[model samples]
Structure formats: C-alpha cells, structure tokens
Target: MTTVELPADAMDPTRDDRKSAKIAAGRVRPEPGAREVGGFGLGREVLRSGQMLQAGVSGDRFSPEDRFCPVFFLDGERHKKARTAIARYFTPKAINTHHRLVMERTTERLLGRLRATGTARLDELSYELAVAVAAEIIGLTGSDQATMAGRIEASLFATRVGSRNKAVRFGVGLVSALHAGRFYLRDVRPAIRARRAERRDDVISHLIDESYPDRAILVECMTYAVAGMVTTREFIVMAAWHLFEDDALRARFVAADAADQTAILEEILRLEPVAAMLHRRAERDVAFTGAVAAAGDVLAINIRAANVDPAAVGACPHALDPDRGTKQKQVGSFLSFGDGSHRCPGAQVAMAESRIFLDGLFAVPGIRLERAPDLTWFDGLGSYELRHAVIACTPAPTAD
Candidate 1:
C-alpha cells in the first residue's frame, strides 16, 4: 500500500478536490463566498437532466437529495400523501390482480402470431406485449399504446449518453412523437372527460374523477405507464435470451417448479440487472464509505458492479446460477430493482408479469434460441437487441 500525505491547507477543506468529494457524497463542502461548492461535470449534468425520468427506479434507496421522481416529487409531509394516493394502484396486491389477464392475453395473442408464422424477432414482439398490457392496465387503446411505445423507444435512444450533440434533434423527434401521443391521449380525453361525466369503471376514469390529484400529477403518472411497459418488456426479452442461449440454465429454469420461481427470478435479477447504473444529484452535503460529497455533485451507483461484487454475493459472482442459493439469502445484495426510498415501486408488478410470460414461453414446445444472430450489448441503453432471433415452435407432443 502507498501512503500519501495531505498538505497543511488540506484541513481547511476549501480546496476543489475536497469540494468535488463533498458534492459527490451529497453534502455541502466548505467554500468561502460560494453558494455551492461542487463543480458541474458530465455526471452532474446527466444526473440532473430530464433523462433520469426514463432510467427507471432501483431496488434500493438513495439519499433524500438523490431521490428521483416520482419518488423525488415529494418531501416531508407531502411525500406520504402522494405515495398513499398511488400505493393502491402499484402495490403487489393490485399487480397480482392484473397478472392473469395481462399475462394470458399477451402470451396467447403473441404466441398465436409466433406459431402462425414459425419465427419472428422475439425482442420486438416482447416489447409490443408489454406495451399492450401496460396500456390496457392504464386504460389506453391499442393505437395509443403503439404510439406511446414508438415515441418512448425513440426518446430512449435520443437521450442516450453519447448522443448529446444530436440532443436537439432528438428532443424534436421525441417532442413530435409525444405530440402525436398527446393527440392520441386527447382523442380519448373525451372518453376520460365522459368518464368524469359518467364515472366509468376504469383506471384513467378513476384518475379523472378524483378531485385530489392535480393535472400535472396525473400526467406525471404517464411516465409510470411508460416505464412499466418498456423496462419490463426489455428485461423480459433480455432475461429470456440469456436463458435460451445457455442450455443448462434453461433446463434448470424449466425443471424448477412454481415454488422455485421466486428464487429463479431473484437469480435472474442478480445476474442481469436491467439498469446497470443509477444517476442522482446531491441536494446537500453527505458522506459514504469515507467519501465526502458536496451539494449538486452527481452521484452514480454502479448497480452491475455491486450486484456482482464478490464480497457481497460470495462465490462465482459472474455466473448465472439460480440454484446457487436460497432466495431469502440474496435480498438486499441483489440490486435488480434498486435500493433505498427511491427503489422501484413497480418491481413486484414487473416481476410477476415477467414470470408469467416466461412460464408461457417455457410451456411452448420446441421453443429454443435458434439462429445465433450477431449480438451486441449497450450498457448506456441498458439493453441488447439481437440482429435476429429466429424461433420456431413444434406442435405440442401428442400424449404418450
């Protein structure tokens, strides 16, 4: 180990590096005549930008200053109020209720198409399935769902890290897409308006009828709809592809009974966390593991790194071994959903929906990863799109 000595003035803590450290930890570093000590950097800019809205929530919580929407939307007394208002819609109970319908409908409809045609891009198909399920749950029409999905896809690529120079163009594209989506939303506004008039039994109708939630708050929930639909869709495809590509894993997965599903899901989440990193900004000074961070410093938690940390998981951290251990043993260490107060509110719903769809997939005979297409992974985008995934299903085996 190398020993380093600090300058005599270092204790003053007015230096820039110390300021950066303080900002990185979400705390205020001492600064003379400075409103804030932190300097702006790529991390801070990206973290504070509107981009995190598309990033999805984590399984764990960040500092209060680091929380992002809709988690970040509230503070103190109001936080409880907002959470209470939305809790019923997102809770495990509510999600479980929606599972059978969404799962069955999606699988039957999609698999029917897949079987009819022998092969297709499973990734795109999965995305469509998730969009349909989410739209239906949130009371959007088929066309509305398609439009939303298209726009979100474009927006995601547009906001991707390396594309900053094209941001304006991306912004215009996303805006145009969202405008089209708004037009679609507006087309149904009359229905929402009518529901407000007649009190129809629908989720959007409920939102419309409720006098408590403001229009902005209601619109913000649209992000939730988009997030739930898209992230889970990508996650499903990615997870399935991982299993299908590895024969041993798929066999292990198929052999596991219903009771084993939970463990399998956790292992999948652990091995392939959807969002590899989370971005946040410090609203105040904070400290973490000896790092002092100041206000306005951008903070990023390496989810992929943390999940695979040898010390955290113990033994063969790199492999995807669902049966490696029991489910109870891996809870917090698994950063799949995220951490802390800003953890994913839709995780249970996403997981249930994913498992159900996967079950249907495994049930299909001759479902295999056919046509090894060129594959590339993008960490920034948090997904991998296959050049092709040619799959064909055989007729179910005749009863012996």
Candidate 2:
C-alpha cells in the first residue's frame, strides 16, 4: 500500500469535526508544497476539465461503441446532448407541473401510513417517496415501485460496481445479471413499449424518441433509478434527523415560505452532503490551482471538504447557517449535488420533493421522534445513510 504524509487536519478520515451521521467527515486539505490537493476552487476546476474521465467501473465497464455509459459519466458532445434533452423535465416549471402531483401523492401516502400505524421508519417512508417520484420522472411506473426498488438494490449488490461486499460480488455475478434481466423485462420493457406506442413527457420517452436501443435504455433507467432514489432517501432522512433534533430549525422550516424552507434544507444538505467523494480520472495531464495530476492518475474530489472549504463558504463554514449561501458566493446546495457538466440535473426535483414531504411530515400533530436513526455507510456508493429513524404520532382513530 502507498501512503502520503500531510498535516492531520488535511487528510484525516476519522475526524469527527462534524457530528454527521456515522462516518467521520473527510478533510483533504492539501499541505503546502504537497501535490495532493483539495478545495472548492481546485475541485471545481477538476470537475470542469475536459481531460477528466469518470473514475469507476460504471464508467469504464462499457464503451460508447458497444453501449453508452450512464449519462452522468458522458463527456463532450454526447454528454452535452443528453443533458440538453433531459433538461426539459428537470426545469423548475416541469417539476412543478409534471412531477409535483407525484411528489405530493407519494408524501401523502407515507404520512397516511404513519397516521394509521402510529409509527414508521423514516428511511423506509423516504425511500418509498423517492422511488415513486423518480420512477414517475424516469417512466419506470409500469411495474411495482417497491419491486423495482428491490431489483435495483439486489442487482447492484450482486455487482462489484455497486456492491459493498467485495468477497461475494463476483460470486454473485450471475445473480446480478439475472436480477438485471428481471428488471429490464419487468420494469424497463413495459415502459419502453408504452413510450413507443405513445410518448410521455419523461426520460424514457425522450430516449425512445432519440432511438436508443433497449439495452441502452435499460442502462439509463437503472442509472437514473439509483441516482435519484438511493441518494435522495439518504438526504431526506439526514435532513429530517437534523431538523427533528433542533426545535428552532424545525420551527423555522415549518413557518418559512417555500423559498426559505428550501434555503434551510440547502443548509442542512451543505453540512451533511450524502455523497462524500466524487472520483475522476485524468485522461491526460491536468493542472489546477495548487496541484497537477499526470495522465492516467485517478482523482477523488472530497465533497465534504469542498462544501466546508473556508475559502468558499467563508468563516464558520461548518456551521449550519441557512443564510450562508447568500452570505457568501456558494451555490445553494453547495457541491453536494456536484458541479459542471456532470452536475446533478435533478437538484430542483430533489429540493422540491424534500420540501413537500417534510412540510407534511412536520405538520403531523403530536409527531415525535421515537428512536434516533443509526447511521450506516454504503461503501459502494461512498455515502452514508440514516436507518431505523423511528417516527410516531397518535394513530388515526379506528373507523367505527
């Protein structure tokens, strides 16, 4: 194994400098004269580089001539084309118009379940909500939502690319392929057929319109599913945990207007970014600010570090100040949703969904946090998830 020495604050992975769920926050601040580096300024530059390639199996597993990689990893003209086409659905107006109903309906269903049961795990509800909203936008609504979610997770768990269990991943390779087959057959093909017969204002329909083959479409459907559902669930739970523990913030969130409520959530996201690290491999030599990466070197941009960078967010970067975005020049969600061509297109969709769900959630009279969520880290995704966040309220009276 190789190691590089630097100041402890600059590279400690165990620093609990922030009490953010299970993982100790990362601080990759480069030491003076050290080639290894991280900061919002340099990180942003790295993301924007044309020489960068997505740095994981997901990117390198397939070639464009055979099958397209996930759109998030696409670069140059193809990437631009995909982003431009998908932009129609992610725009604020599109989310409010095409997706708001799905968001509201899903949130209402989860809250109704909690009201009836008197308690539920926050993560489960959030996962369901995330799945439904994302499925609707991606046009995976033809099959069972929960079943699709299970298939996606199961398929990923069977593959080395998405599985945390390194030992069993290849052993389960056949299982992963089978699960993927079932997913395509059960979830994807139906959507493709429906979209082909009559297009809808969704991603799959757009792909069909663009003549993407079935395998390519399935690749995209599954990619969007994981990106939208898995990560958003973690963010919702993490945000709720923070607000539930702080009465002032919860009250502020509930009382604030939509824009302000979103502002508050953005601050929470800034402090507890779900995806801690984003990797990129240098296609050629790259130089940014304080460092240089040679051709073929893989780089990891520490999102947590960049989000809390002193230069980007100003003094007290770690503090949860809702007004910090305006106080400084940082983006609303910080770098949590990422930046440049690879930036998350669903930022508004996530923010809008979170606000709608949380507003209804906090409004539950007598709602209480029964058990604090324990944190679990997903090594494959390089993210932390809150689990077993038990929330309860008085059950809706049994019908006579």
Candidate 3:
C-alpha cells in the first residue's frame, strides 16, 4: 500500500471529508490492469481500480459477449437494446392500462391478510404481493408465482460469506430452490406450445402471436418477473417504512386529495433508494467527475451517494423532507432507476403498483408501528430483503 501525505490546511468541508481524506493520503492507488468493481473484491479497491488510465483492456463489458457477467445483467448496450424492444409493452400508457387491474387486485389481497391480523411482517407480505402481481402480468400461473420468486432470489443473490456454516447452508437452499424453478421451466417450452394451441390473453399468448423468438420472449418474461417481482416489493416495504418513521410525511401522503402518487413515490426513491448502486464498465475511456476511466474498467456509481449529494440535493441530504416544493427535488436527477440509454422501462408500472399497494395499506384504521424493521442490505445481490418488520393496524376508537 502506497501513501502520500498532504497539507492538513487544504481540507474542504464542502466535499465529503472521507472521500477527500483518501485522495489527500494518496490512498487512491489504481491496480495494474483494467479491473472489475465490487464483485468479491473490496468495494473501495474495485472503485479505485477504474482510476488507472495506463491499463489496457478490451472494453468488452458492454458487449453482448459479456451478457452473463453480472455487471451486464443490468448494464451495457445489450440491455439497452433489450429495453428498447421490451418498452413496446412497458410504455407509460401501456403499463397504466395493464397494471391498474393487477395492482388493485394485489392491494386488496394483501390488505385482506393484514385486516385479519392485528400485526404482520411487511417484509414477506410485500414481497409475496409484488411477486404475485408480477407473475400474473408476465403470464405465470398462481401456483408458479411463489416457487418462481424463491428461485429468482436464490439464483440471483445466494452468496457465501466465509468457508463455513448456516448462512452458506441457507444460500445453498436458495440456489437449490432457484435451480428447481429453472428445471420447472424445462417443460415450459411444451407448455407454451400447448398454450399457443389454446387461446389466452396472457403475455405467453402475446409472445407466441407476435412471433418473437423463443429465447427473446423468455428473456423478456424473466426480466419482467425480476424487475417487477423484486424492485416493486422493496419499494412497497421501504416506502411504508418511510411513512412509518415520519408521521408528518405519512400524514401528507395520506391526506392527499387526489391519486397522483408520483411525487410521494419519487421522494421515497430519492431518500432511501432500495437499489443503492448501479454498475457500468467503460466501453471506452470515459471522463466523469474529473476522473478518466479506461476501457474495461468497472465502475459502480453510488446512486445513494448521488441522491444525497449536497451539490445535487442541497443540505440536509439524508433527511426525508418531502416538501422541497419542487419537482426537481423529488426526482433529484437521481440514478435510482439508472440513467442514459438503459433507464428502467418498468418505472411507471412500479410507481402505479406502489400507489395501489399504499392506498390499500393506508386505508387500515389506527395503523401503528410495532417494531422498526432491520433494513441491513446484503451485497452482491441487486435487491433488498427486509430482515423483519411488524406493524399493527387496529380499528380506531369510537367517539364518546
């Protein structure tokens, strides 16, 4: 490790002191070659690896050849193209039309469960609700939804921290469940064939009728499943938690006269964005914030950092003050859904689904917090899982 000392007087309070301290101490050493970021390596080291301008790399991370590299699972040009094709279905107008019914039914179902129980765990509740609605939209049967969700979570983020024990065992279980879902899909090809023979209004029928290639259709279906299944679930729970933590803000949202939920949703996304970071590997030497990233250099932009940047959002960055009195504050030019050519196509659907879920959730009388949930995130997985949360929604007391 190389270190270079700098003058103590040159401190800038305007910048993040920790970030500045690293650069001042020459702690920003670049590794020899263009390298990957944030995968089994130290997050800081991976971030700094992109600082090397001299390293030679193929810059192929964004190419179709690297599609399975985890980074490209949600990044790169192929994702962009895939998004373009998929956007035909996920357009704002289309999502508004198709997802409204799904959201309503899902909200009612979840609220029904909550109404029966005085208190319930929002973590499992929201995830299951989101997955069910997503599965229905993507043409998966009700019987398949729970199994598919388990599989997707396992395959996507089952990680082992060390050489031993129960976390690893649980991860193995997750992977097994995920693999089972894949195995189930092995018969899906014939299932699709039979479904094509019979008439249906689901996405499977549409894919067949539209004559999309089998693989392309499958990928699209899975993308919708993961995007809607995981992301929306996180949004619902996180947003509810946000409301629970801040009573005034919750009241603001609850008292809103109309159903325009975009502003409220935007603030929640900006404040504690469930997807904390977005990954990209340089296709060419790209300049960002005065740093030159060479080809093949993997960069993880901290959407959370960017969202809370004082430069971007002004002071009191972490505080969830929704009354910023402007649209820009709500969006904050955040990379939450990503930016550039590969922004999330399902954003509208996500917002609408969250609104419907929240509408049902808030309708319960005397909703009270039972326990603050643990929101600690697991790295490597590109989503959030709430460890636990319990809230009580009892009937209000009658007037004397």
Best by TM-score: 2
- The parts of candidate 3 lying over 4 Å away from their true place are 1-81, 142-144, 160-183, 186-191, 198-222, 257-260, 325-333, 395-400
Report the lDDT tens digits of candidate 2 across residue range 1-400: 1123334235443422244633544433222222333588888888888888766635667675443566776777888887898998899899877799999988999999999999999999999999999998999888988888888878776433544577766667777789999999999999999999989888999888878899989888888888899989988998888788777778788999998999989988988887777777788898877788898887777788888887897666666677778878667778888888888899899999999999999999789898989886766676776889999998899989
Model 1 stretches astray by more than 4 angstroms:
1-76, 142-148, 154-157, 160-191, 198-203, 209-222, 324-328, 372-387, 395-400
lDDT of each: 0.55, 0.80, 0.57
Query: Rank by lDDT, descending?
Result: 2, 3, 1
lDDT, candidate 3, at 128: 79
| lDDT by residue for model 1 (121-202), tens | 7777777778776666556553455666766564445334344458776766676566545644553454455556676334
Residue 359 alpha-carbon offset, candidate 1, angstroms? 1.2
Error of 1 at 36 (Å): 20
> Which ranking of candidates, highest TM-score first?
2, 3, 1
lDDT of 2: 0.80
Candidate 3, 245-345: lDDT as tens digits: 65656777788743435676676677655665555556567665435567766565555556665555555555444542263433532556755554566
Q: What lDDT score goes with residue 252 in model 1?
A: 64
Error of 1 at 76 (Å): 4.5
